[model samples]
Target: MGNINKRGSKDLVVDSDQSQQDSPTITVDNQLCDAIIKEDCSTIKALLRSHPVNQPLTILTSYRLLFEQQTCTVIPIHLAAEYCKPRSLLCLLEHGADPEVRDTQGHTTLHLMLLHWPIVSSTWTKPGNRIQRLMADIQNNAVSCLHILFQHGAQVNAQVGNSNKYSPLHLAITYGTHPILSLLAQNGAQVNAVNESSMTPLHMAADILNENMIKTLIACGANVNCVIPHNGNTALKLAVCTASSKAGQLLSAGVGCIRLLLIHGAHVNAQDHEGQTALHEACCGGREAIINLLLEFEANVNILTKNGESAIYMYLQRSSNIRDLMVLTRLLYCSYPLRLTNRQGVLPAGIMLPEFQLLKETLVRLARKPLPLEDICKKNIRNIYGKKYKYYVRQLLPGKLWNSIYNCYDLADVLKGDL
Candidate 1:
């Protein structure tokens, strides 16, 4: 019995020794992957050297998607880029990890880098000087990683095979800085590439009211008049609608973004599927600055939606506050027809503010009067030139004197500067 017990003890000791010998080999790959995700540069270099240089390390990420097994196999470069680690990413690239390698989910190194963009972009809103600097550093590191990948022949326009089929440029526009956008643009990304929604980068920019992005995209050759297939809404119309929302009001980028679109020749009279123009949207939302800006850009004051409601009628129907009357005044100043009946068959005068009761008769009489010859000539000239109206007007007058004299035909200060 004693001899049998000694043999069993010896067997147990050998099993324990064997287990110790197998553990490091079993875990070394996982350790390397963890070191990479943690951005441990030196440890990554050390572990990488232990493996065959010809064989790249891969991360086998396992997850459950409904009833299926969604196993994703990604390389060290993708992990490095995903974590925004520039140094480790450069290390992987130098060790011959292909920058164009796509994971099972079809995310290239660049896509992984961009996946973290929103967090970095939104860090500016966090309140702290140290936090701001840290965010800047993180952003710079991510940019540097992209530069390294581009140096290794990464494709700038590769579309993620996800359902949305978003190109790198589309992702960049989601929450990108100007420098990163310029980098992608310079690297041959198609500025007008549309996603599954037929939304160009410009559409995203305008929807978010990103004035700087709109300017950059225009410079990069984005078609200002590109329309969405789903809604037939151009970027200009989309900006107007979005700006009328509470999110839009808070950012206050609506007027500036719309102005940029107009300056770049977005058709002011462009209509959406609803037959509503940007002016109609502004009026419905009671956006005063947008209404005036639209007027300056020659948005047709007489244009009616498919519903048979004029912009003026829409304004009166949804007028919320007393400040909304300011928009109404601008609409009238731009010659919005008071005679046009809404779908409700009511005249704009029928809904006049109580304050306007004193001037109601005068306003009704004025609408009945035809435009004078002086106004007629100006209208004809403006209609003839259309987009070039301001350019010709500037050349004809040749000074600030033109703006003062032609206040009736003047563009906004934003568009006027370009003139």
Candidate 2:
């Protein structure tokens, strides 16, 4: 194949040795595209070098490529990235192939690299050796391609994609590319860059309950309390919402992420657009561990949503399991107000079904009997000190006094009901 020349206003022709009758003239763009699909590094290099300086290379015309019977518009670099052909990608980049060039959908080569990575799901019953090897190769090539692009002065924080305008860091977090996330952060990728949905990389990590990614983002200076612009939902809110449907391994990881966020100063009582806090979301999830964690952080159980629904009210409406009932019991012991009414004028106690007769009776009794004065004082003290009270108390008090307060068995005993 030789240089591309305009045969007519509408057609591009590639000069070749074969006669026109023997091998009909093919479009020059098609010739280069075929080389890209086949990963012909030598052919690509020849075409780039021998192409006329005045004409320049219109490689963008060959954006569309067929993969697994699906047609997607992709530049040569993106195609190379997808196929894990690092040699071809580097050759194209050296030849002026823009690493920042976006496809029709505004996705850069970096976005395609993360998007096409082979994700091995837990549900796969049997992954053959070929599949495993293929996955490993893909991962290796992806890392190499990323490094090459960065070295070539690719914008680390360039937001691509038509829908969300996601930065490379966002894609890394979304695709579970742990190493890539770290690389991007270390290379000056904006840790707090919000996507089209106002979600930062931290929000994405928290949404998936990825503890390691969360830690990485936080260490890179992610704002722990940064709320999504539209929903005003923080990373803590996203974590609680995600933990609801997760189970077993994912649930444990979710719990850990929440704990990590809280320890890093995530506000427990931060409300969303509807005035619902992390406690409200946890209650809606009906997970005992999450609810207990938020309660221990002193999430105001009596806090109301825009609709006047409290956390306990939402819990009652969403969950009916015995475990959830026990969670409600714990909330009651924590002094969640029993007399709160929602916007619809429905009280939490009045809506209790007959199956929860014991709970209903207990709530009635608690409503009539005043909480212990000492317990009320302790609750107030905790509220004043905030969740990091223990650390402050330790720093302010002597070891013996601190131990005495820390080992307050009566406080623990009162919180733990005999039932």
Candidate 3:
């Protein structure tokens, strides 16, 4: 059998039966590649001028010369951008290289620039200063390179990469090209452009938990409530589900991202395709802080997903250990409706492990009891004053008194019985 490779519109074949020595080799002009790497404009110009017009040579030609064995076709401008060679990039554009030319993977020069940006180590030490200087220079050059491409009529909103259909802004946010994100926005990149998955760049930012990028997109007028079309996931829902950590290890920035989105008017109770809200996602995460934050923002604990699963049901079903029992207790404290059943008709209590019998009994007892008069007053105040004022009310009340009113009882004593 012969091995087939696709390059641009052409297909090259290699015989698998051929020995390594018997295979034909393709050679590229090393000097042209060297001139590009060194950013030698004069040499590049000379080389281009010397090549016959009939040959139709280009920067892509130079790239092919160096990497003939590469199955993926990349253009010279792509290389310049990847290497942060601003001078070479500008020179190529001046010489009529297409800034919008996509590689085999459908990444334009702009996509490559941000996607392959140099990684800078955070460790501060003796060699760090020099590395930091180099990073700064590369970043500045990358910014300049982006500006040049934009000025030369690059498509600011063109979707890149074959599978992802990511707009340049999406790439910028995904790759941490912070400065380029703002520049792209200012240069008329579509802030709310959806990828192949119908996810906007804001969704991507939320998934990565980049609060600054989220702010940048929101300031640029990216819709905070923009929902993925297929699944109907808003940025807030994504933030809750895709948060980079689990439970106690939850990233503060991720929580802050969710809070920021909510403040900016991301729909807290916005449901996905499955009718699950951000609160449902937080329960699945089993993170008390996120669950608390969502509840504070008025996320409905009793809202049922398409499967008829409430946030409390999700918490009990997904929670792995006693540590998460406190999260369940907190949900109970919030007065999550206890009588609700899932699509399977199983109540939250029905899913309890034998180990959680005490916790389950406690929850059932609390559910049957009426709210104390003080708690009713506080709940009314909380509802009237809104989520932000609840904190102030807590501060004004004595610690013991407030805990009692909100049913903020500790679960440690129950857990200690098992210990």
Candidate 4:
């Protein structure tokens, strides 16, 4: 009986010590919590100096003492954010709390701030809801917190482990926080890093159509042609597939990037897993300027994909841009014995319904245009100036314009069949 009592006493002392150690340092939690709740600085400073490495799990528990008992282990920054104390939050971050520390639910300080600040601010009814405060925090010291995490080797490339796997850089871009993205990139974030869906920062930039971000990424040497691992879609491919403003910006940037890729020896004939080339993308985008440029680089006009669709077919099917239509016609007529069959074994002309019959007929007229007198000329001099000049004139001026000189008639009236 005496031995058992002694053993029980020792066990009780061990439990007590464990309890004391498990408790957050009371003085530190009280002082910091007071600062955070009251927006006090001196108390926060004294508390920081005393226990510079103190954590906030206890004061948060005290808040549960104030409210009902709920699991509350958020850090001081998160608490500051909760109380709408931006200045105090900044102080805590400056003092050495880990911003990237995950809560029990795995939310970081930024995530907490992003999630809760607006809610707390919204309860005030009508003073503008602390938007400027939150934006300022995010723009200034919060970005520094993000940078600090990066400096200490945090992963900007980390996805949220959801289906989307959006990285920090992806979030910054999505939120239009340009400064954060720039900081992340400067801190060695992968500009072209992909998410679980195999979408790179370039893909996000293109999807969002942030022209400045896109240009910045391109300038930073993002692989413009980096294909998504899952679908084999390039940044250019994704850009063209959308009807959003981003598509316009990418098309406006034109073949400069595309030309850069091609000049650097990007496979002009490289097909997506779907078997579409950059030319096909440009045509489908109805970007006349880019289509012209791609053709100049000799992008495969008749290159069939696994589905057997040619660039011309995609242009006719997806676009109403007159320039794309003209360029497609030129590509088809200029090719050697052009075939109209797409990847699906559907001829572009035969597949035409009422929507595209006019276009199809127009293309047929262009394809059936007569060869020039120069091709028939035997002499070198005639050959130089004859058929070539005829082709040039026909290409440069419409049939009506040429007929005004040839038939001595009113070009507009005659072309409209009025005469």
Candidate 5:
């Protein structure tokens, strides 16, 4: 009895090398791969009785693999999602396959489904009949796969990679439909989730001027004031700096985007890591409408960036504004600080186009004269509210005595008198 107790019939511990030698290899899972190709869940279930449900099997896909001639490493769930095989996916999930298992590219099953889906930028309108049919079929297939994965407990907010860290919400903005976005948001995907580049879905929305996406994101409690990583760019700044030229589609939407951003309490004067503000970006881009809206929200013309470049300096960089001079008139009306200079102590007149000698002289004269009393009071009120001045301006200052001055001050009329 003592001998049997001390020296057990079975070995006390399994050898590491022996376990490794006994484990199944890529070549050993040929049956699993064949079942995945046929989406034969019955065979998969039968096989899973003897093997692991989450075993890495080789399969042939159009993109990653081809046929009997080629193959790539993927678990059953990945193969199912990649092929939009919801039944196969559900089967694997039912058998306890991990829904969040990543592919070679670090994409989860949801990522595989999303990456292959086609997106037409004009989500509101349908295209030609042929394209529309194609889109509908694709949308159904992709959406079904997403629903199955979600039902199986796949992470809605699961990021793509360890280093890249792009959330599913970010991908949905580009490749996903409103249903996918809604599903993710409803299932607790962080609306404000930041990627490795410190970009949020709101930033992408602003870049593309997707008004619907912007409104939806903000309604879901997105931070309009959130900035990017290195450059620290806010959504409003990105909106002002929108550089898209898609048949002028995105260009005309600039005013609407800035309006939405400003109305929702985006800081008009929110500075970047380099201390540049949205007004500066608008000025640089020569965006008259955007600049006007920024000024209406009380963007400080006197705010100098880290390089000591004021809005006046930025406005002059665009050659198109030279003939118009409307920007100069607006700057004067908004009480752009007169004596503010660049890093080298250079005033606007110092680099002023010789063609506008008359305006240069006027600028010099304005610098000598004191700012108007009304302008002084307005500046003081704005300063009191600091960065959060937009709310108070709409509520308090537009009261009894100065309502006309606050709300209806004529820009052209005021500039004519000053000049």
Candidate 6:
């Protein structure tokens, strides 16, 4: 038999030597790698002394080996910048290890420095010493490190590559590091830059409920209604979806931003790709304050989502408290009639089930008057459900409802035909 055997129709040949030569070599030396990984200064210094000449490949290989394995305890640089000896980091830098090299997660040395700086310094609190001094060192150093990376031509907008798809700006906003955000923006980092999920720095600020960050991003020209690439959600929509007290604070800061967007020509009634408007988000988030703001901007109440859900529907679905339900009920009354249906043709009254029934009964009582047949019957009915309904209406409306009712009554002659 030959080295090559005959196949069904043709002879086959194999080159073992060629195949062996084609295989990839590990390239990086294991001993230097282990020394870096262990952060064994003696071992690393000895290796450097033995090598005599600095090589980029050798330095990078050692640096990466330690970083990849996370032997930060020994390799102090892998520890927070504060905990790590400056000399070791300087040594690595001198040996041509890229100061801006990121880890497996794309978090650069600067990113690790910002996050871990605080952690390392948390252990060094002194009673008489102002804590600000310690924080100042970390902050100033973090700024300097960022400058170093920027000078070295590191990517200013590199994404973190996870659920947030966040860039450095996203991290700054999330961490409430406004100064860092400003530096990144000044250095050409995208202000409205979105993450993998299509969320902007403004959106992240909203997520963290950082009011000042929201203002900063808006001031820097972040698009207020910049939609998520995946679902077309806007920064405002995300804020409204978060119903915490922190969410409220962010919404207040964002109120001016929303107004700016409107004045600059954001579509008040513009729906997402799914046909949901900002109104839906405000309602679904149960944020009456934001809802009122959307209304002021003339958001369309009648807009329906692809699934045939309207803002009122979402509001009703999300209403967990009496106040929330009451606010939504009032808004619904001000909008289309409860009989107005969505794309599915399901009316508000039909969709809310038991809640709708109770509300309907209340409305009927509120609207009812004694038939002209008898004053006594009218008074009795007033004494029954009518009085309580009026009281409730008074609480909701004060002078407003009565004024509206007077207007309606005065216009009744013209509306009589429709009635």
Model 4 bad stretches (over 4 Å):
1-34, 37-39, 45-73, 79-96, 110-138, 147-157, 243-269, 285-290, 296-298, 318-325, 349-351, 354-419
lDDT for model 2, please: 0.68
Model 4 weakest lDDT span, ten residues long? 1-10
* Local error of candidate 1 at residue 404 (angstroms): 16
Candidate 6 vs. true structure, TM-score: 0.59
By TM-score, how accurate is candidate 2? Answer: 0.74
Which one is best on TM-score?
A: 3
Kindly list the per-residue Cα lDDT of model 3 for residues 334-418, writing each as its tens digit. 5433544578867564347676676666655655767767666755554444455666878889987766555444544554453
lDDT tens per residue, model 6, 319-375: 252234445444443343232345775544432566455554543443353334443
**3 or 6: which has the higher TM-score?**
3
Residue 269 lDDT (model 6) = 75
Q: What clash pairs does model 2 have?
A: none
Alpha carbon lDDT of each predicted model: 0.69, 0.68, 0.68, 0.54, 0.68, 0.52
Q: Residue 404 deviation, candidate 4, in Å?
A: 20
TM-score of each: 0.71, 0.74, 0.77, 0.59, 0.75, 0.59
Candidate 4 per-residue C-alpha lDDT over 1-419 given as tens digits, one digit per residue, 9 for 90 to 100: 00111110111011223334455674346456666767686777777776653365453231323543222334666566444465676677677766666665555655443333221222333344355455444334444445445554555555564566666666666643445567667777778877777888777776545656666776666777777776787766554445223446454653444545445444555678888887777766667666766665556666777877777666666535433334543444434334456545565543366655555555555346554654223222222332235446566677865443233122222223311
| TM-score between candidate 4 and the true structure | 0.59
CA RMSD (A), model 3: 7.2
Cα RMSD for candidates in order: 12.0, 8.1, 7.2, 13.0, 12.3, 15.0
Predicted candidate 1 versus true structure: per-residue lDDT over 30-52, tens digit per residue:
56666776677788788877864
